[model samples]
Structure formats: structure tokens, C-alpha cells
Target: MRLAWKRWIFSLLAACTILSLHAEDEADLEQPDDVPWEEVKSTLPAYPEAGEWLPFFVTSATTNTFYIDAKSLEGTKDGVMHYTLKVVSENGAVNVTREGMRCSTREQKLYAIGDDRSKTWREPRNNQWVFFKKWAINRQLNVLYDDFFCPGRIIVYNVNDAIRALRSGVPVSGKSSRD
Candidate 1:
């Protein structure tokens, strides 16, 4: 009789715990979805110097070569990773921009553009966070997010980890290329 009573009590406790968790989940689901998320203020970094550019492979299909500024990589407290990107096309046209990526939402924002002649940064007209597209022509940001900075949908721990991941061509957290 004692063993049976103990078993019954244990089963009851387990069921009660499961129901409580379920109730909490239901409450969470009932909350409004329009709650605004707060983002940390961003201070734009200086334009990347010529020596700070580190080439990263995105895909072989495109003739444009992509590079990230080693000195501009930063992991912010709000989980946003900021960096400067430089793209050189086969035709010799070069484009440079400062950008930020949020691993939590898989979104990217263009902060500023670099003027090669003045070696200065200018704020982009549309400096809004937008979801990454699936098209092949714009795969540079996606590659950076998937391979180096935000593998497994989690941001790197710090700037050093991000630089390490870039240099090694893999994620620092041990997640595989596409995990």
C-alpha cells in the first residue's frame, strides 16, 4: 500500500507540473504580438582603412569579391554585430559600406557608405533593419550571418570571436557552416 501511494503521488506531481507549464505557455501565446522591441543606440565606426580589409569568400558564382574590415567588427550588448564591408567587382568598381546584423532576427541594416575619395563615411538614406533576401545576387550579408558571425542563429560572444571566425572561415561556437 505504501509503494502504491508513493507512485500515485509522484504521478500526480508530474501531471500537475506539466499542466502548469502548459498554462504558462498558453498565457504567453495570448500576449499581444505588437510589443515594441528596444534596440541599443548605434554609433557609426570610422571608415575602414585600406589595410584593414579582410577578404571573405561568399560564392563563386558572382564576379564581385566581398571583404570585411577587420578593425570594424564589433559585437554590441544588444546582440547586434557591426562591421564594414567592401565589395570589388570584376570590372574594377568598388563599393564600401558600414552595416549591422542582428542574429536574433536575421535582419541587417545599412548604416553608412564610404566615399573612397574623401575616405569618409556617409549615412545611407534608408538605414533601416530589413530581413535578408533569398536571392543569389545579394548573398554577401547572408553568407556573413550564416558562416562567421551568427551560426546557428546565435551571435558571437565578442569582437575577438567574430574576428577569429572570419579568419578561420568558420563559426567560433563550433556550429557547422549551415547549422
Candidate 2:
């Protein structure tokens, strides 16, 4: 009796498999490899150095240039750090906020950079269009600390993996690491 039952189950499973194969939607299948991909272009920075984490940035940076100012960075969770960038413009008067984007690690450690607003009417005084990255809210990055080290781009991976790379030396670029 047990053997017969086993045989019945196997036959039923085989039938189900055959039926499902025929029932699959065309959309579920992959496109034919012979078909060519559509030609497309963009004007953004591409960060190939950005490790496993799905690279995200303002201006669609990842869509173009991969160059990052390692010198303009601060502490990395392990070897990676989150980041955001803001551009300000000013002539001799007020401060204006320009393009800005916030990029966080998979674990959500924040990162951001602030620059001049480009509008003299809104520009901040006593500072020359200062640009710097803020680690924590109250904690600001030091531009000339000399002790600060910049982490690399190949740090944390995805949301599934939350480990980071640590930096102990100056980054490749000469931009301010902290502001």
C-alpha cells in the first residue's frame, strides 16, 4: 500500500509539472538573447567602486562618472560610508540651496555634503562657499584635521549584508573629507 501511494504521488507531481510548463505566461520568460538592447545615454557619474550596495546618488552620478573624492569623506562603518551632497551658491549676500541628495548605507548610517547655494543673495557669510560632509547631525567632518581618514567605495554591500570596511589612510582625492 505504501509503495502504491508513493507511485500515485510521483505521477501526480509529474502531471502538475507538465501543466505548469504550458501555463507559463510569455512575459515570465526572458527576452531572446539575439535581440539587441536599446541604445541609451545619460549624463551622470558612475561609481564602479561602489561595492555590492545598489549605488545611488544625486544627478544620477552612477549613470556616468565613478570618480569619488576619497579625501572628501570621513568614517566608514567598516570600510564603506553613507553620503549625501548639497551645492550652495552665493555672491556676497544670501545663501541658496542647490542640488542635493542623501545616500545611506544598507544599515542606514547617514552621509551628506553641503556647499554654497550659488545665489549671492542667499550665500552664507564668513565662509567661502564651504563644502563638507556631515557624519552625524551635531558631528561635522574636519577638513584639515590631518588625522581624518577616508573610507573606500567598496565597503558595505546590500541590505542583506550589513558589514562595512574601515579606512585608516587619506583617500585618493584631495577634496575635503569633512566639513
Candidate 3:
């Protein structure tokens, strides 16, 4: 009878230790590293031509139509995805931006802004990576993060994968690829 009790206790302790170790591993995955993040240098993309812009759906409340330049989609070696985005307002004004998104950290950084008149790109004065905000009025980054580019917190495997997700209107992580 004493041997049976010892075995049961041993089994319980072993299970507890395994579970504890698994929990620690999960915590480690969730924690950010103490090392400062260094962003890879990005080059500004050319101004998106009207024909190259592919429209994407954002929130219904927004009057602006969002688009991604089909030709500008790029996946970098450092896990940063670069693309040029275009925003067309209902009033006929257009805004273009070249940006990079880091799927692992849910952060985005603006690389440059496009001038439609001169067809030139200019760097933003405050270019930096910022986390996506849940309550932002314009949830373009969130839509891209959750529905297309960074689904499941993993970036699309390549530029073609990103383009596929954009064209199919389905997330990269989705079980079914519409296209």
C-alpha cells in the first residue's frame, strides 16, 4: 500500500514539473527580449501609379478607400514586410505612404511619403516603429495585421504570399485560400 502511494505521488510531481516547465516556455515566448530592436534600412518605393493600386476594404465608417501597390509588396530577410499604401479620400485627395510592418511585434514604421505632383518620395520627420492601437480611428494597420499580412502573428512567407492574401481577400493563415 505504501509503494502505491509513493508511485502516485511521484507521478503527480512529475506531471506538475512538466506542466510548470511548459508554462515557463510559453512565458519566455511571450516576453520581449532585453536587447534593443534594430530596424533594417529601408528604401523608398516609387510613387504608385493609378493602375498599380489595388483597393482594400477597411472599416465601413471610414470615407477613405485604402489600397496597396501591387508592385511594391516585398518581404525582407529580417522579417519586415515593406509595401506602399495609398489612401484615396472621397473628396479626390490621395495620400501615399511607404511603410514596413513587423509581424512578430505588431509594429509599423513609416519610411516615406509620396508627393503626387512631383512624383517623389520624402522621408517622414518622425519615422519610427509604433505598435498598432486597438482604438485608433483609422485601423488600416490592424486590418492588415489581423486579416491579411500578419495573421496568427506570422508574416506571409514571401511577396507573392502577401499579394495572394491581398488579392484573395483571405488571411494568409486562413485554412481556405479563395484564389
TM-score for all models, in order of appearance: 0.74, 0.18, 0.74
- Expressed as tens digits, the lDDT of each residue in 1-179 for candidate 2 is 99779768876775575455443242432223555423122112222132232211222111221122332232333333333222222233311121111122112222122233431222233422123332222122222111122222233224112221113223223333431
For all candidates in order, the CA lDDT equals: 0.74, 0.28, 0.73
Pick out the ten consecutive residues of candidate 3 with the lowest summed lDDT: 22-31
Task: Supply candidate 2's per-residue lDDT for 75.
Answer: 35
Prediction 3 TM-score vs. true: 0.74
Model 3 segments more than 4 A misplaced: 1-36, 175-179
Candidate 1 structure quality by residue, lDDT tens digits, 1-179: 99779768876775565455422122322213465666788787766665477787776555688888888888876678888899999998989998888877777899999998898988799998887643323778778887778776677857787787778877666664434
What TM-score does candidate 2 reach? 0.18
Q: On residues 21-104, what C-alpha lDDT tens digit does candidate 3 reach at each position?
A: 422132322316677656677667557766476677776556789999889888776667888898999898989899988877
* Best candidate according to lDDT: 1
Q: lDDT winner between 1 and 3, please give it.
A: 1
Worst 10 residues of 1 by lDDT: 22-31
lDDT of 1 at 165: 72
Q: How much does each candidate deviate from the true structure in C-alpha RMSD? A: 17.2, 24.4, 15.8
